[model samples]
Target chain A: MEINGVTIEDTFAEAFKMWGSRLIITAATEQWAMTTAQAATGFGTSIIGCGCEAGIGRVLGVDQTPDGRPGVEVLFFTTSKKSIAPVLLVRVGQCIMTAPTSACFNGLAAEKTVAVGGKLRYFGDGFQSSKLIDGRRFWRVPVMDGEFVIEEEFGMQKSVGGGNFLILAESQTAALEASEQAVAAMRQVPDIIMPFPGGIVRSGSKTSSIYKGMTASTNTAYCPTIRQQVESVLPEGVNSVMEIVIDGLTEGAIAEAMRYGIAAACQPGVVRISAGNYGGTLGQFQFHLKQIMA
Target chain B: MGSQLNSEKTTAVSINDDGVTLRLKAPITLPVEAESICPDCFVGCQQSEILALPVFCGRRRKMLGDIFSVSGEASDRITVEGDLTHFKRIGQGMSRGRLTLRGDGGMHIGAYMKGGEICVEGNTRDWTGAHMTGGMIRIRGNAGHFTGAAYPGEIRGVNRGTIIVHGDVGNETGARMRRGLIVVEGHTGECTGAGMIAGSVFVFGKLGARAGAGNKRGSIVALGETAPMLPTYQYQCRAQFGFLGVYLRQIRKWGIAVSDDLLKGSFRRFSGDVTALNKGEILIHD
Candidate 1:
């Protein structure tokens, strides 16, 4: 399949089940809310090194927030349910709690809960108090800037991670521009996060590494420099490839994200669009490139 | 507010006002516990069966049918019309359904109630909503002492739920309350929120002397005039609270009147009851 002269590969993108939580962070102003949200989601590109994959989901209006302040919603995903709380505690404590005039609330209403402010309340040194408002519990920890209010618990749900597609172009600038356009378009889709820096990963990896101790290594088949040395998958004239990795709350969300991303990446100078998968050896969710593009 | 009740799904029980004033001719005493008259518990009971339910009236055991004329089909919505100033424990411990009272209610109204709603069109005596765990109690007239407060020997009061009073309340309102919200649109007597453990007390009218005395950890928002606080309270800076908007919007849904200025204004924060937990705060609008 092809669109706008960009070839759509027949392969599929593999994704695994992950535990996820949505957080609504509100502040006295939009800048502060975005500041805290961006910092909280930083250094969280992939579970391979960051222990989580997170990104800013969207900017929320004042009427949409619980506190009636300008806010930002973020999506954080981890490999298991047990890891979600610790990651959230660390991120919120260091990023949001330290921010000025900020409050954190649970964005999701799942049955399964993880302690977010329940454990962070200890920072108050026995002075922390709680308030139950409209059936939701909020912890008020006395801070230097008045108080830091956070929900007692956050809901966790099963999510899909690692939904991705590769953008191959004739030059490095072409690949970068196409990937930027794809990220911009994918950002419009909700409940999904492109965790990579600039929403593009230059060093896409295979299932495992050639070394004994390594779990994953770079994808040699799509390497422009090693095209003559390996069994390259790139079509002729394709000199650069960049992948857009997506992690979302559901399979439908990921598919929607890929649809927007792949369509936007099929711009000028883009040669082909392909997906990475383990040939059904790993992960549970599979997004076929043709089906998603179609 | 009584008009909100759907008469089609309600069982109307009218009090028989005889010339001799037929009070509960009871074999048991101490203001009868009429908790079983709720729609949730009286699901399949006929009007005759409901009137047969035992109740105590001034040291006497009597049938509800002996005092009131019970009519209408059985349902979760019930309307009681009468001058029930002598009746106690109306809608007590009811976990689900809706109860509406047309006239004055006696003491212990909605005590220990876990869920559902109770709308009183008239006044209520002391101990209203005591030890209530959930649901809402809305009184359109004056309420006696200890509204949303703990019982004499109990440690907590109105653990969960909301109590909205459209008129004045007696002393010690919301005393020892552990959770939930109590909004008084009229004046309140002395020591409002005294010894409050946790929860919120929002008074839209004047507050009597020594408000928030010995409060441990809670919010006492005085939109109207309030008496001087105890010296134990330390003054904090003034600032606008963001959570009040959410709280006001929620209560406004129940038809409570809230001013736009109070919703957008700043408050002078006073952390008080240093003799107790010292974490409670009084936010008086500036």
Candidate 2:
């Protein structure tokens, strides 16, 4: 299949089952809300080194928030349901709670939930107070500027992670531009986040590594410079490759994002679009590129 | 001032067309213990059985049919109509279903209620929702004192639930409340939230004198005028409270009007009832 004359590979992207939580951070202004959300999701790109994967999902207007303030939605993903609490403890306590005019609320509604504000209330020492409204509990912890309000529990659910698509272009500039367009398009899809800087990963990896204790290494087959040194997957005209990794609350969300992204990335100078997979052996979910574009 | 707060009287004999309704035959002067009026009591019972439910009229045993004319089929939803000013414990210990009282009700309207909803279209007397563990009670008109308060010997009052009084309330509202919320849109009588343990009482009208007198860890928010604080209370600070915005927005859904200034306003905090744990706070809108 082809989209705008760009080849759509028959390969699929393998995604693993993960636990995820959505947080709605609201502040006095939209700027403060984005500031706090960005801070809480900082240093979070891949669970392998960041302990979790996180990104800002979207910006919300005042009418959409619980507190009637401008807000931002953030998504956090962890390998296990049990690991999500500790990750939230650190990010919310060290980042969101420290920001000015910010308050955090659970954006998801699920039966399974973990305590975030219930544990963070200790920061108030003996001054913390809780309010139960409409069957939802919220904690008020006294801070230096004012009180930091957060929901007592944050809902968690099974999520999909590592859903990726690679953009193969004729040059470095073409690959970079296509990746940017794809990232911008994917950002419009709800419940999904591209967990990479500018939603583009230049260093796509393979499962095998040459160095000891390194589980992953660079994908030499896609390296244009190494075409003569190894059996490269790149065609004669292909010179650059950039990947966009997606994490979403559901498999369908990831597929929806990938469809929008791939269609947007099929611009001039793009050679083809493909996905990374381990021969369909590891991840629980797989998104076929041609099927998605179709 | 008292006439201004009277809610529009609902004259419908049956508030819910599909539910069982009990219409009083005539006005009564003597207090009647009518805990059987609760929807939980009528659940699964036939229409005849509901009419035969036992009640106490001034220490005399009587059937519910003796005082009121029962109608409709058996269901978990019940509607009571007419002058109920002398009926007590109207929905005591009810755990599920809905109960609607169309006129004034007597004391202990929802005492020990565990779940479901009770809507009082008119005024309610003292001890309403005493020791309630769950559910919600919305009083459209004035309420007598001890609303959401504990029994004389119990440690907690309205442990879990919500009580919203749209009109004024008599003294000691939410007294000894351990948990839950109580919102009064009009002025409260003196000593409101006195001896509160842990709960929230938001009064949009004038806060009565000596409020939160012995509160240990509760919050009393005064959005309008407030009476003079007691000597046991100490000024804390004047700062914006983020949590109040959340509470205000939630309450607005229940037909309570909220102004933009109050939704994004600052409050003067006073930590007190130092004579007790001194952890309770009174926040007056600034």
Candidate 3:
């Protein structure tokens, strides 16, 4: 199947189960809130090296927040539930708490929760206090500017990670432009985040590498410069490729993002749309490219 | 003060209903014990049975039917109408359901309440929501002293729940409260939050004299005029607190008017009641 003269690969994208949590970071202003959110979710591109995959989900209005402040929603995904607590503790305590006039709140409502603020309350140094509003507990830790208010616990749930689509284009500019357009469209969907820089990954990796101790290596087959040195998967005219990876609270959300992203990427000079997988041997979920578009 | 009802009747009244209503038959001059008027008591009984429930009027034992006209089937929601200034214990120990008082309530209206919601359309006397553990109590008018407070000799009061008073309250509101939130939109009598163990009392109007006296780790926030602090309390600092905005915004959601200035304003913090834990704070809006 194809659209806009771009071939839609019959292959599916393999995704694994992950544990995810969402945080609502708010500050004195929208710019500050976005700044804090960016700082908190920064350096989180892939769980393999960064310990988690995180990105800003959306910007929020005052009416949409718990404290009636301009805010941003950020999502974090870890490979295991047990690791989510430590990852959040470091990110929220080091990143969010250090930001000016910022407060972090749990954005998800799940039965399973991890204590983030409860542990951070120690920063108050015997002056910490708590308030229980509508059965939800929030901690107030005194800070130099004022106080950092955060919910006592953050909810976590099983999620989906590594839902991606590849943009194969005839030129480097074409691939980059199509990838940017796809990322912009996919970002509009809720409960999902494209974890790579600018929501596009230029270095798409394979499951293994020739170098020792390397869990992942470059996808040589799709690399334009190394096409002659490797078994190239690109068609005759294809010269550049970029991938957009998605992580979301649910499988359906990932699929929805991928559908919008693929359609947006299939533009001028794009040769084909494909997905990377381990031949369907790994990952609990598989998103068939043609089936998703259908 | 939480009371358990007959198991069989508890099951009977658990069914959903349109709402049971009780109307006073005539004006009374003496205080009446109407604890049986609670939704838990009327849940399983028919209108006739509800009227047959016993009540103590002054020194006389009387049937509820003799004092008021009860209508509707057993249900979780109850409506009481009349001048209930003499009626006491109207919603004592109730664990569930909605109870609305169209008229003024006497003492102990929602003492020991565990769940559900109680909306008092008129004023209420002292001991409103005393010892309540859960649920919400909204008084649209002024409330007498000891609102959300512990009964004398009780160790804790209103451990969990919320009490919102739209008008001025008598002295010692939220006294000895262990936990929960109490918001008074108008001026308060003297000694508000006195002997508070742990809780929060927000007075939007003038705070009474000697507020937060003997407080043991609690917060008394005065958003309007504040009286002079006692010698036991010491000056802390003047700054903005993030938690206050959260609480104020939540109060606004409950239909209470909250100004933008108050929502974004800073407060002068005074850590006091040094005579006790010395950890309690009185925040005067700056």
User: What tier of docking accuracy does candidate 3 attain?
Assistant: medium
Q: How do the residues A1-294 of candidate 2 rate in per-residue lDDT, one tens digit apiece?
A: 888999998899999999999999999899999999999999889998899999999899977898889999999999999999999999999999999989999999988999999999999998898988888899999888888999999999999999999999999999999999999999999999888888889998888887999998889999998899988898779999999999999999999999999999999999999999998999999999988998
Q: Note the chain A TM-score of all models in turn.
A: 0.98, 0.99, 0.99
Candidates, ranked, lDDT: 3, 2, 1
lDDT of 2 by residue, B133-175 (tens): 8999999999998999888887777798999999999999999
Off by over 4 Å in 1: B1-33, B71-74, B242-246
Full ranking by DockQ: 3, 2, 1
Better of 1 and 2 by lDDT: 2
Per-residue accuracy of model 1 over A84-162 as CA lDDT, tens digit each? 9889999999999999999999999999999889999999999888878779888888888777889999998999999
Who is ahead in DockQ, 2 or 3? 3
DockQ of model 2, rounded to 2 decimals = 0.65
Candidate lDDT scores, in order, read 0.86, 0.91, 0.91
Q: Which regions in candidate 3 have their CA more than 4 angstroms from the true location?
A: B1-3
C-alpha root-mean-square deviation, candidate 1 = 5.6
**Top DockQ hit:** 3
Q: Evaluate model 2: give its lDDT.
A: 0.91
DockQ of each: 0.44, 0.65, 0.69
